[model samples]
Target chain A: MTRSVPVRVHRDLARAITAIENGYASFGDTLATLPARENGKASFVVGVTGPPGAGKSTLVDRLIEKFRAGGETVAVIAVDPSSPFTHGAVLGDRVRMQRHSGDTGVFIRSMASRESGGGLAPTTHDATALAAHAGFDVILVETVGVGQVELEIVAVADVVAVVTVPALGDSVQTIKAGLTEIADLFVVNMADRPGASRTALDLKHMVRESGRDVAVLQTIASEGTGIDDVMVALTAARASESSNAGRAVRFEVVRNIRDAAVRRALAVLDAPRGRSVLERLRAGELTRLEAREELLVYALAEVINAD
Target chain B: MPIKVLVAKPGLDGHDRGAKIVARALRDAGMEVVYTGLHQTPEMIVTAAVQEDVDVIGVSILSGAHMTVFPRIMKLLEERGVDDICVIGGGVIQENDVPKLKVLGVREIFDADATTQNLIDGIERVVAEFGRARKRTGAATPAS
Candidate 1:
């Protein structure tokens, strides 16, 4: 049996990681609880996303070197919604991170997002914390293909980078509309390809039309070009977040603690009264409104008991 | 409580279709699934399995890294003293790896294209056996 532990201790970190992975955090708002020891660990979560063949894995490879050279531990989470189709990525992320395998400071994980919205909820989020809890200073999540659900990553990250290739056709409505806003920085990869410059220019025009302050970068990825500038954009964003001083992260942390407590109360709980009402509903002994009342009482009791 | 599972991606393999599908079907079946996101090492996974206290540890691997990663996880679990937990697998595993895996004590192997129903039924059955084994050891006994 696994005994519970304090969430801030190193040994207990695994237990906390498990709690998050298991959907214990999902039934309520427990996702925001600050560790008992805030001083213990922290990481910059950077999300990089774009369509397939945009050289995200390769960009990540170069980024690792830039971070490691400064003596920072880097954790990479690459989400792939298409497994067999991604054909080479299972090997690519690994091969790219291989040089650091011996360094002990780099941990890279690739996930197939097959379930609804890419099934990234439990896996990628838990993995990020596992890295932060393991003491990494930087974590990168390379989103699987952009989908309706990939938007969930925004909840877990501090900075969002939307990666795209040169000459994306006008047919991509979602990319042009949905992605352009959330992106703090944009990278036009495969810069050597024809029409790459034109695509960047067109994207810039499209973005400018929207009147947003997004940084656009161009990269030839294979030769390790233009990544440093991307890093500069990322760092600037993080620095701004900390200095903004609204303390939104603090509020989130507090909210999560309360939510976790409520959820735990919901579990290990017995609503004999609610069950009896439900049983009445099943037996047609009570109207739906009556059942609703019983449920409301149960929900209130849960919050009270949780405290 | 429904059977709880921890589906983990260990190593560098990025393919997760099977893992995600299994997670969804299991959740739909009323199972509680705790997914340990990708790039898990044997150490991280064992630590997760123990903490989640799942009835089974189902790892979906296609990276050819399974031969090395799986055994490492098995050994890590044994060391952690949760060897009683059932281990099952899927993905493009070679037929030859099956026998060795069974020797390592995996209960069942589901090949590709196995229906979602197949995985669900297999997990339910394994969970039942797991409960029985726990009872035999007097680790936990049900009200019935």
Candidate 2:
């Protein structure tokens, strides 16, 4: 593997991330060459996620200020949804954080969630790892506006802050399964709105009932109000042993294995030998399930033989 | 795998209608467009381009600061030792200043008469040129 770019250089770090985003053939080698964290202190990754129009970006912008003021080098990975049809995206998350553009202590990258259903771009993990390797003390990952089940943030961040706004109608929206389970802290951003206290209270009550130690903080992110408390809560959350630590590694390994298997299976299906099974199915000589099993067998054989 | 372009409105121009339209058109044409909203400084724009590692930057300057803005951006990119990212300009520029801006290493200047298709085609062309340059020197070497 050729390691041409120095991973610690800012310019080279940007290039390394681009290589990962574009799936350059040797990007893994570049990542592999990055020095491991010293003293077991890797960059702290904070995942900020919420529904559309929840001010996730605005809150992230404020948090970036708070983190930077503490003198930590911060890197942000903001992901936006790609058009399922065109695979293109208009990444506007940086508009709110544009003030930090010239600040050398900050590095922000926008990514389009192409073919990744997880609210994050496919290469977000790789990019975050590269940023950590580049020696950032904090990495803030802002996911695409999410709904109930974009729980992939749990697999990446040391702390997951789920930002929600007030007057979301039914308070039941707050207790939904996937999001509530993953949140280490809940931020009622845009807290100046009408139902701010009520929303916060509901969340607090829900957390109490669930017997979880989750902290709920309120903030009008646009005004930079209540941000300090939110930051404090985040610090506390980070101090706690994350339940996702072991699960995250296992999740990544499983995902990688799944991706590789899918690739190999596709390769087998595209080849003549595997296509014959499809032909048999098409000719009514084999059932769909039978053909699928035959293809899986071929794919498994290919995977085993390659070893 | 996709072409990434940064569309920014630099200077005091509040007129982002043109910039937004171009960004939307680019996105619809299968390009990832980063729209950095209004009144961005040249420094901010370049910082964004470098951090985003965008293949091209489309600066929309209707503030008549083209003479000041284009040169500053070009100089900044040069100072940063970044040549791979292409810079293009659009919106309310006098026809006579087109060649002048191009001389400053602005890849292409699209005026009012230039349609969305023209802008898109021009961007794709310049991005392809940069891609070829990168290929020739190897991807690790910055395109000179």
Task: Specify the highest-DockQ model's number.
Answer: 2
Candidate 2 off by > 4 Å: A1-8, A32-40, A169-171, A273-298, B132-144
- Give the C-alpha miss distance for residue A94 in model 1, angstroms: 7.3
Docking class of 2: medium
Q: What is the TM-score of candidate 1? A: 0.54
Q: List the residue pairs that clash in candidate 2.
A: none
Query: Chain B TM-score for each model?
Result: 0.87, 0.90
The sequence of per-residue lDDT tens digits that candidate 2 reaches over residues A1-307 is 1112232356667777777677663556656545554535678899999998899999999988988888787889999999999988999999999888767888888999998888998889888988887778899999999988887887789888999898885668767788888888899888878999999999998899899888999988899999999889888767777766886887678777777788889999899988898899999999989988888898999989998
Where does candidate 1 stray beyond 4 Å?
Answer: A1-15, A25-42, A52-58, A77-104, A107-134, A147-155, A170-177, A206-213, A220-223, A240-307, B1-73, B76-85, B88-104, B109-124, B131-144
Q: A249-276 in candidate 1: lDDT tens per residue?
A: 6534654565565554455235566667
For every prediction, compared with the true complex, DockQ reads 0.09, 0.52
Q: Return the number of clashes found in candidate 2.
A: 0
- The Cα error of candidate 2 at residue B143, in Å, is 16
Error in Å for residue A133 of model 2: 0.9
